[model samples]
Target: MNAPASAIEQLQLGLPELDWITDPNRIQRLSQDFSWFSPVLTRQLEGKVADAVVRPRTEEQIRQVVAACARLKLPLTLRGSGTGNYGQTTPLAGGVVLDMTSFNELLWLRPGLARAQAGIRLNEIEKAAQAEGQELRCMPSTYRSATLGGLFGGGFGGVGSINYGPLAAPGNVVGLKAMTIEPEPQIIELRGAEAMRMHHLWGTNGLVLELEIGLAPAQPWLETLAVFDDFDAALAFADQLARAPGLDKREVAFLASPVPDYLTQLAESLPKGCHAVLSLVAEAGEEALAELVSAHGGRVSYRRTAAEVSKSHKTLMEYTWNHTTLHALRVDKSLTYLQTTFTPGEYVRQITELSRRYAGEVFMHAEFLRNMEGQTNCSALQIVRFTTEERLQQIIDEHRAYGVRINNPHTFIVEDGKAGGDLPEDVLAMKARFDPLGLLNPGKLRGWPVGAAS
Candidate 1:
């Protein structure tokens, strides 16, 4: 990569019409994200301010900026709401940080589909769809603050994953308009299988300009928070709920233990000495849901009727599993997290053992989802109170030693989507075709050419 030119003047002359921020403090702030698991390393990775941070409001503006960067041989990094956890958007090599938030717009909403500008918040688009008696098919825990482009580029399974699967599945993405960094950056619209491949590529393949997604009919949902006397019962209940037929929509499911006092707030009305399982469902399944809880030795501690849940959709959506975990971490100044996936067969026993082993050091918080085979698969995000950075690394190493696949949570990125797949050689060739200069998020995505600086 070329040595960065004088930050302010280079960007000023490169895209004279675009707004550019060169102040050291402001640039530093834009470079980092909400990744608290490894605060010190997070800051290190987000080191140095870009010569300029540019926010483009129109596709034309984005293209113009890209064209100028290509001409100057400057690296460009794309950013959305910065809600990612894997350092995916952090400018490791400072260049022009393209803030995509200003491009927010709801471009189209028709039966079974909705399209919006890359920068639109997930909640904003869902609200517009709900007014038309429809809604987003799936959204991550951070929907309220997460932008559409951010989710497409850097999101994974959320509370609703049990029903809709991961966001990268073909059923979720219908099309996308992206700007590639070939000899001449050009805007291209892709649909069907091709578009699905682009979902969750971590902004490596190209910069998403707009998104067309599949939508689901809006249903009156009932929210329930249940408390279990033991962790075993909570995990079993969640697994049973996932397998239960006639579940209108198992939107969000979470199992929390005492370590994460955040649940103490949501389950405040519950009696002491109990773990909790929270869920959201369509109103029509209330009777059946009650039976399922009873069968698993659990009781609904707090219930929001369909009317209440509907009225509070925006708030409920914002506090998905991750938000709950974030709130708990805030209670303790020294807390970080871990991301791991496990099969449902022995989830209860495995989690219980691990929690007991780590005891005061680790808190167990789980979000349920389904594997590609339709079997129960889950991602458990473990938040641990702060300790030495070396000890934290040891904890992650120990957890992985037990056979769980851990996607280190210290970064703003999550590993999932088609980007995780081994693509055909032609697919790699195609990437080279669009990114001849190898300037797009270089080291990310499958088949991404090697030897490019991350």
Candidate 2:
């Protein structure tokens, strides 16, 4: 149970040119992520721990580590901030965890794009870009803590997805610099369609070193939390504002009754029975936002400028997205969540039916977003009242029967129920080309079953 000297010694033996960690406590912490958010994963991956952790300071050190792991056939799982909900950072094969935090650095900033090392905290990048009059296109709710590389590796989309679309959406990611696993690794700069091969691959293919991402012009935002007579109206108004022309917005989320009740920090602002629609609209568009809310039968419950919100040290975004699920879990440990996407015009109908069918079991929370084609849509991160694992799958089945897409968070395998769920040929082809040895994060990808590539 003590720190294993041999674990660190093996890494040192393999790659003597790196800083390594074998302290059992630190190794255990490095091996975990928010994957516990899913009860299924908690049960499945419980007690699974990494054997060692190797922290790389530069891209050269990463190359040396990847090459060593490939030679030793050690499953090297890449670790960013480990803010991912899936067990993307957990080493199923019990090998070396390649920690990337030390690689943090802001390399450069151009007019419409910026380049930075993989381990840089998103907030760090945002601050640098803001100083240069730009900001990240879209960021996950864990904005301040999550590294941009982790965002590309496991995240979907959040705050800025309303306008910039998902991370996989074209133009969001300009390019990525990746290093393949082999005796002598090579850093490959992937661009256009090629860069996407590594996206959401769960760091199973290669280690991302640096990324060149597209940026949006910086804007002063008004952090507004509005109240509504009904959940439906709040959602409808948010949808209207999402599509409204000339009105710029960053994040827009609709949280129903009990969901808002779970937020203790804003308990005084939100009415007891009222639903809430949280958003970060452009400061210049505040008038338009107010008009839209009034027209849709809602009133502004709380309003703060970005500067004011920052002063309070709480962001409305932290109250939306998976943050909503996290807050509820803080209050009641018995709840889990479902990641779902709904069609454009049928949100009302589908929401009504799901509410009636599951009733109090599944509570509705929708975050409005735009797809790759710039079409308006929403992904629901519904909080569920836990009964049993079988019942959870049944709820998922019911939703799928209604044509809703569920991105199963319970499973660590790359394949799921959606198009992205099934391993795409593009990624497979990329792996075949880059990771011929099959040493990087071996057990995480189902498509590349143990030694299948061999």
Candidate 3:
């Protein structure tokens, strides 16, 4: 529910020059993200809306809104392009949603690094970096619309994660500028690990203003699909490709059997009853990739040269990562997904065993990535045939029993969605220091007591 209209009106009147969206319908629409991806989150976050939205075009304007909200003790939720799936942009406590898209600007670009305002879109940054013969080291599949800040605040890694790991990995995110929640907002500069304290906290710890990120040298990536009749062969090919240090690749995903069938757009390429490994490797490594596919008894079913993909503006990337879930949902509405990490060396065995255990119930879809400790493994975003919430929890528990870590996506509570048990004391302390009154995304961080001050 929205806060009192009078309060929102008062905020608007105070900042008469600021851009405000007061239309209830538009406000409601802007209040939501892709959280509807999960039936559980859909139900829990139902009817949650921000009282109003403010689109600040300048850093000065943002400070004004921040100060006013803090003085009024109003809950504030920071938002970007709203591409997140876990209700990261949803305002659990009705107040103000600070829309940051207008604040976008590519601050500067240097060799192996670039800095940009929090609202800059990932694609925009990539295009700019590409002009400099560099590209983002890691970005989500929704890079075209997802903002740099949105990815930093709520995203793990995607696409290029095989080489760089997640956004939280050391050196990926060099530094950031954040604003504390207070009447007199303090703009702080945090570097290295200090800046990452706010990472993946769902924007509950502090408000990020700008970020400096590392970049990878540009490559002409060849997008292809290696199809195999045998599921084990497909998994092995993807695993080998991920572990092959000599083959330069951006992405490697295994879509087993029925999972490939769900990608209707790629139906022609994804032959019936075949497991597929979608990959993005350097154009120069095409012959090597083909050799590996043949070694594993598979065939290249689809091929799109970098130039063709660039001209057509279509790539297999749109059909991998969480995009796979989206396409599957489009084809079959009765499906949900799980976020899981398998034991590194045992990933293939674990996936093989689980596929047998669940078979038709859980469709195996894995993305090969390097973990924080630089270990090679695959994180599975398995598509499940949703029957009931109880059954979903059971599936998660069973996976945990099999030694796979499940990061529950169904919960809006920051700590609950995480794989680890509870928020670290340092994380809680970060929240207290940056958001003393707990006014920033109030209900999302369960560890903080409401209205508490440092």
Number of the top lDDT candidate: 3
Report the lDDT tens digits of candidate 3 across residue range 15-128.
999999988998998899999889999998999999999999999999999999888888899999998899988987788999999999999999999999999999999999
What is candidate 2's TM-score against the reference?
A: 0.95
Tens-digit lDDT string for candidate 1 (1-454): 9777563467577677887776788787777566544665565574544666888888888888888777666667788988876666666556778899999999989998999999999989888998999978788778878899999887776756777777866678888888887437887888877776555656766778999988888877777777788777877887778767778765545555664345445546456657767678788999999998999898887888767765665445444556756766667657777777775586766777888899877878777776666666677777777677788778877877887777666633323322133655555655665566766654445344333633
Candidate 3 runs further than 4 Å off: 1-5, 449-454
Residue pairs clashing in model 3 are: none
User: How should the candidates be ordered by lDDT, best one leading?
Assistant: 3, 2, 1
State how far residue 119 of model 2 sits from its true place (Å). 0.8
Q: Model 3: C-alpha RMSD to truth?
A: 2.3
| Candidate 1, run of 10 with poorest lDDT | 412-421
1 versus 2: better TM-score goes to: 2
Candidate 1 local Cα displacement, residue 317, angstroms: 3.9
Give per-residue CA lDDT, model 2, range 332-422, as digits (tens).
Answer: 9898999998887777677767766776888888888888778888888999989899999888888888898898888877775242455
* Off by more than 4 A, model 1: 1-8, 264-267, 270-272, 310-314, 411-430, 442-454
List residue ranges in candidate 2 displaced over 4 A. Answer: 1-8, 14-17, 417-421, 450-454
Clashing pairs in 1: 84-412, 85-411, 85-412, 85-413, 86-411, 86-412, 86-413, 87-412, 87-413, 334-386
Model 2 lDDT on a 0 to 1 scale = 0.84
